[model samples]
Target: MKARASPSIIRRSFILPVLLMLAFILPFMFLRVAYLVLESSTLCSSPLDCMRLRLFGGSDSSLIMKMERKVQSSRWRESIYWHLASHGVPKNLHCLHLKLAEEYAVNASARSSLPSPEYMSRLTDSSFDHVVLLTDNVLAASVVISSTVKNSGNPGKLVFHVVTDKKTYSPMHSWFAMNIVASAVVEVKGLHQYDWSHEVNIGVKEMLEIHRLIWSHKYKYMKGEDFEFLVDHERDLEFLSPRFISLLNHLRIYIPELFPDLNKIVFLDDDVVVQRDLSSLWHLDLNGKIVGAVVDSFCGDGCCPGRKYKDYFNFSDPVISADFRPDRCGWLYGMNVFDLEAWRKTNITRTYHRWLKFNLDSGLELWNPGTLPPALIAFDGLVHDIDPSWHVAGLGYRYPQVSLQTLKAAAVIHFSGPAKPWLEIGIPELRSLWTRHVNFSNKFFTKCRIEE
Candidate 1:
C-alpha cells in the first residue's frame, strides 16, 4: 500500500484465486450432472422421480426420499380411483339389466326351461364336453357362450355351466333362456344356489376384504403401519379389482369341490372370444397335471423373460424366499383346462386354502390379491403347458403387435386387461374382434342401445 502497487500486480492477485476456485468447483459440478444424466436414463424411468431430481435439490437424502414416497402415494391413489370409476357396470349393461328385469316382470314364459332333465343329467356326465364359465356381466357372458358355440366342432356336445351373483342371476338366466345357442346347452345358476361350507365362505369374505383394503391403500392399517408404504407394490392390484375379484374369480380356486362330478372341464373367462374349435382341448391328455394352460409367454418352462415368481410374491419374507424360487414361470388364467380328477387326488385345494390362510396371517404380504398368484403357488409344478396358439391374451389394453395371421390362428383371444371390449376405453382395432361376435340386430341390443 505504501509503495502503491502496480495495476497488473493487483489484477493478477484477484484473478488467480477466482480461477482456482472455478477449477475446483467445475469438476464436482460436471460429476454431479453426469450422475443425474445416467440416473435419469437408467434408474429414473418414473416421470415423477425424474422431475424431483431436476426441480427439488438433492442435498437432503431424507427429504428426497419423503418427496418420492409422497408422489408415488398420490399417483397410486389416483390410479386406484380411476380404475374403480372406469370399471363400474357400464350404461349399456345397466340398460340391458333393466330391460330384462322388466321383461321378466311382464312375461312369465320369458324364463325358458333351461337345462332340461337330459342336459341336467349331462352336467355330471364325463363323456360330453363341459365348459365352465363364471361371470356377472350379462353381455360378456353372452359373447363367450355365443362365440364358443359358433366355433365348436360339435355344438350339440357342448354344455356351458354359467354361474353368477344373485343380483345378475335373473338377467343372465333371461339372456341364455331367450337366446339359445345352436344345440349348446346353457345352464345358468346363481352363486347362492351352491351350498358353500363355512370355511369356504369365510375364505371368500377374507380375500374380498383384503382386495378392498389393498386397492384403497388401507392395507397399511392391516399391516400395522399408520401410513402408506413408500413402495408401490400394489401396482398389479388392478388384476384383483372389483371387476376381477367378485365371487366368480374366487370360485375358480374351488373347482374341484364345486364340480365334484366332473372329470375335466375347460374353464373360460367371460372376457374371451372363441375363434376356433376348442373341442380338441377335451381330448388332449394333461399328462396327469392338474392345470393345463398356455405359459403366459413362449419362453421355455421356468424361463419366462418378462414376469416370474418374484413379481407375484414378496420374496423378502423368509417363508416365501425359502419355499419358492423367483425365476419360476407364470401362466394365464383366462383359458385353462382343469383336470378335476387329478386335482382332487392331490392336496391342491387344501394347499390353496392353506396359502390363502397364510397370506391372511402375514397381513397379505405372501402375495398379491388375485387368484392367479396363489394359484401359481398352489399349482406349482402341476401345470401342463399347452400350445400358445390355443390362447392369445392381452388384447384389451392397447393395440397388440401381433400379426393378423396370429390373431386368425388363435383359438381363443382374451380381452383380459382393464380395457374390456365392451368398455369405451377398449382398443378400437381389437374391439372389432369381440364386437363381431355380438348380434347387433338382436332386439336386446337394439333395446339397450348396444352397438359397436
Candidate 2:
C-alpha cells in the first residue's frame, strides 16, 4: 500500500484468490452432480423401485420387504365388526337397523350380529369372539345379544363391545353391565359428547362421535391384533352381494395390509350395498399411498364445493400455495380409508383438533366434523381414484336401476345421497334388489318382532 502496488500486480493477486475459490467449489460441484446422477439411476431403474422410494423412504430391497411386512401385519388387516344401533329398538325402526346388521354380516364372515335381547346374557358369558353393539334409540340389550348369536356361527371367542352414551342406557342398566359383565363401552366424552349450544353443530358432534368411536375401537381392540380386515357399517346399510366373506378374505390375503401407517382407513358408508364381491377393491395395492377415494363426479370438470370455505377459515393450501381448489379430488367425501399408523404419527389428529378448536373458537359453525383438514394432512402427494361404481349417491332422483347397474360394475356401492331406502321416497330399484337378494319377508318381520 505504501508503495502503491502496480495495476498488474493487484490484478494478479485478485485473480489468484478467485482461482483458489473456484478450485474449492469446483470439486464440491462435481461431487454433487455425480451423486445426483447415481441416485437418479438407482431410483429410476424400475416402477417398483421408484414406488418403493416414494412410499417406504428408499429403494433398498430389505427396506421394501420390511415395509411390506409391516403393511401385512398392520391393524387394518384385523377384523373389525361394527354395530350402529340407537337406544330403543322400535318396531318401525327395523328398516334401517336390521338392514345394516344384515349388511355387516354379509361384509365380514368373522362378524356376528347379536341383537339386544341376546346381547345381555352373552355380554356376561363372553360367548362371542367379537361383539359390537349399536346403541342409539334402542335399550334392547337382549336384542343385541340375540342378533349376535343369530348372526355369529361361533361364539366361544367372543369379545364384547358397545358403542353408546350414558343416555342410551338407563343408569341401572349401565351400572349392571359395568359391574357384572366387564363389558367395554366406548363413549366419546370430550369433544364427541352431545352439545345443545347450537343446532348446526349437532351434525358435527355426531360425526365426531362416530370418528371417536372408530378411534376408540382401534385403540382398545385392534391396537396389536393381526387379522384379515376391519369393517364398520351404519344401521341403515343394505347388502346386495352374497360374496362379502370371500371379498374380505381376498383383501386380507392379497393386500395383507389395509392401513399401513394407521393414518388411513377405508370407510364404506352403509347406505350403499354391494353388487359384486368387493374382493377386487380390497386387493387394490395402495403402494404405500396414504389415501384412496372413489371419484365422486366422473365428469372430471366438477369442483369441490368447499374451496371457498378454506378462505373463510384462514387456512393455506398445503398442496398448492394458492387458495384451496374446489377441484382437488381427495376430499374423503363419502367412503374413504385411512392409514392409522401414519395418522397416529402425523399431526392429523392434532390438525383436526386444531381445526375444530379454530372453528369453535371463532364461533364458526361446521357440518360433518370437517373431513378436509385430515384429508389434506394425510395426502402424501398421491390419492388413487376408484371407479364411480364404488360410490353411487342414492338420492331418490337417480333411478335405482341405473344405480344398480353402476353397482354391478363396482366393488362397493355407497349410499351417499339424501334419500335412503328406509325413508318414504324409496328407490323402487333398491327395493327390488333387496327383494331379489335378501329374504326380506322373513328377516324383515323377524327384525320387527325382535325390536318390538
User: Which candidate number maximizes TM-score?
Assistant: 1
The per-residue C-alpha lDDT of model 1 at residue 426 equals 80
* Alpha-carbon local distance difference test for all models: 0.78, 0.39
lDDT digits (tens) for residues 370-417 of candidate 2: 344444543435556666655554343333334334455654444333
On lDDT, the leading prediction is 1
Model 1 regions lying over 4 Å from their true place: 1-85, 197-234, 237-240, 299-306, 399-401
Worst 10 residues of 2 by lDDT: 247-256
Question: Across residues 193-250, which tens digit of lDDT does each residue of candidate 1 receive?
Answer: 8898898788777766655554344344434643465244444535545654566777
Candidate 2 shows a clash count of 61
Assess candidate 1 and give its TM-score to the true structure.
Answer: 0.76
